[model samples]
Target: MPLLPGAEPYHRRGGPVGVLLCHGFTGAPQALRPWAEHLADAGLTVSVPLLPGHGTRWQDLRVTRWEDWYAELSRELLLLTEECERVFVAGLSMGGGLALRLAAEHGDRIAGVVVVNPSVRSDNPASVLLPVLRHLIPSRPGVVGDIARPDAVEIGYDRYPLNAAWSLARLWREIQRALPRVDQPLLLLRSPRDHVVSPANSALVLARISSIDVTERLCERSFHVATLDHDAELIFEETLEFVRRLAPDAKADDHQG
Candidate 1:
């Protein structure tokens, strides 16, 4: 499938400390490009893969399942771990779920995890109907560009593919079962007024995870896509700080300028 302009995956080689960034469902790498570049500029190797079924037409996503997306993330993560001495996984929304799953399965292999308004579970009534509705409906209105910036636009399909949503639900269920196994340091940033993912999702993961080091920050001005929203710089800086505290010898302080 032909990828949309500016939606290509990103990879940059920098230092022994590597970071793998994953975008949310229905979102392209475009959403997290700035964040990846910030880490790369700070001399950290970075990999941001465009998940399967994203950055293309909505119909194409309908045919894909969560496993396909998780496989792509896993591939990039393994590649980074092979070359870097230390590695971290950062994700937004559904990508956060994938990160959590990685931490669960890999244990201390993942140095830490950073998530922005992650969605593990939703109380939306529509979600309950996804299994049956997916068979009858091809798409529904999508929640894209939930940014606080007045003119910012997150270029993704306008329609939400029901079949893919059902697959996402499956991923969520699987991640829930493995939450107790995630012991890596966790940094969770959530927007107070997120219109897409609810705060409960983050709270649920926070309550269940066994990580001894966990920090939660409030993105006061941004929305769901906090990586690209008003608090973007804050997110980038905090991430660097988190990485530095863990890998003190890494040259991550260079990009703080």
Candidate 2:
């Protein structure tokens, strides 16, 4: 499958502290490119890998599962850990769920976690029929590019793969069970008017996670894809600040001013 332009994986060598970024289901690295570049420019080693079946077509995603996606991210995280003294994981949407899972499984090895509109559970009416629908239907309307900015576009499959979505749901169940084990410092950025992930998802995560140092920010003007929406710059700046707070000794780019 040929990847879309700008959807290729991004990596930059910077300092001893690293950041691993993961994009949402159906989304490619293009969605996180700016964020990755910002962190990288701030002198942090950064990696944003395109998931196995993403950045191509919905058909590819239909054949893949959550394990495949997580495996790829886990590989990147492991590689980052080797060269960097400390590593933080940040993800959007389903990517956030994956990051939480890593924090649960890896524990103190991960320096912290940052998530934007992450989902561990869904209360949508369609969710109840996912088990049966996944077999009966292969695709549906995509939830990609749910940004408040009308001119912003997210490069992703036009269709949503039901089989892969079901796999995501199953992963969410396991992530919920492991939530209590996510003890790292956490930063959650949410969009109040998100049409896809409900605010209830954030509430559930805050209620379940054991992270004592949890911070929440509301992306009031953006929708589901807040990273590319009206709050994008704010998200970028806040995330950079989060990293700085975690490792005060790390030097930032003078050009940021």
lDDT of 1 at 254: 64
True lDDT of residue 50, candidate 2: 94
Backbone N/Cα/C clashes per model: 0, 0
Which digits, one per residue and each the tens of the lDDT, describe model 1 over residues 1-257? Answer: 78988789999988889999999989999999999999989988999999888898889999899999999988998899998999999999998989999989887679999999988986676788898999998898888889999877887888979999999888989989989999999999999999999889999999999999999999999999998899999999999999999988566446532
Residue 228 displacement (Å), model 2: 0.6
Q: 1-257, model 2: which lDDT tens digit per residue?
A: 68888789999988888899999989998988888888888888899999999988789898899999999999999999998988999999988989999999998779999999998897677887999999998899898989989899999888988998899888989889999999999999999999989998899889999999999999999999888899988888888888889977456433432
Q: After TM-score superposition, what is the CA distance of residue 65 in candidate 1 from its true location, in Å?
A: 0.5
Worst 10 residues of 1 by lDDT: 248-257
Which ten-residue region of model 2 has the weakest summed lDDT? 248-257
Model 2 gets an lDDT of 0.89
Which candidate leads in lDDT? 1
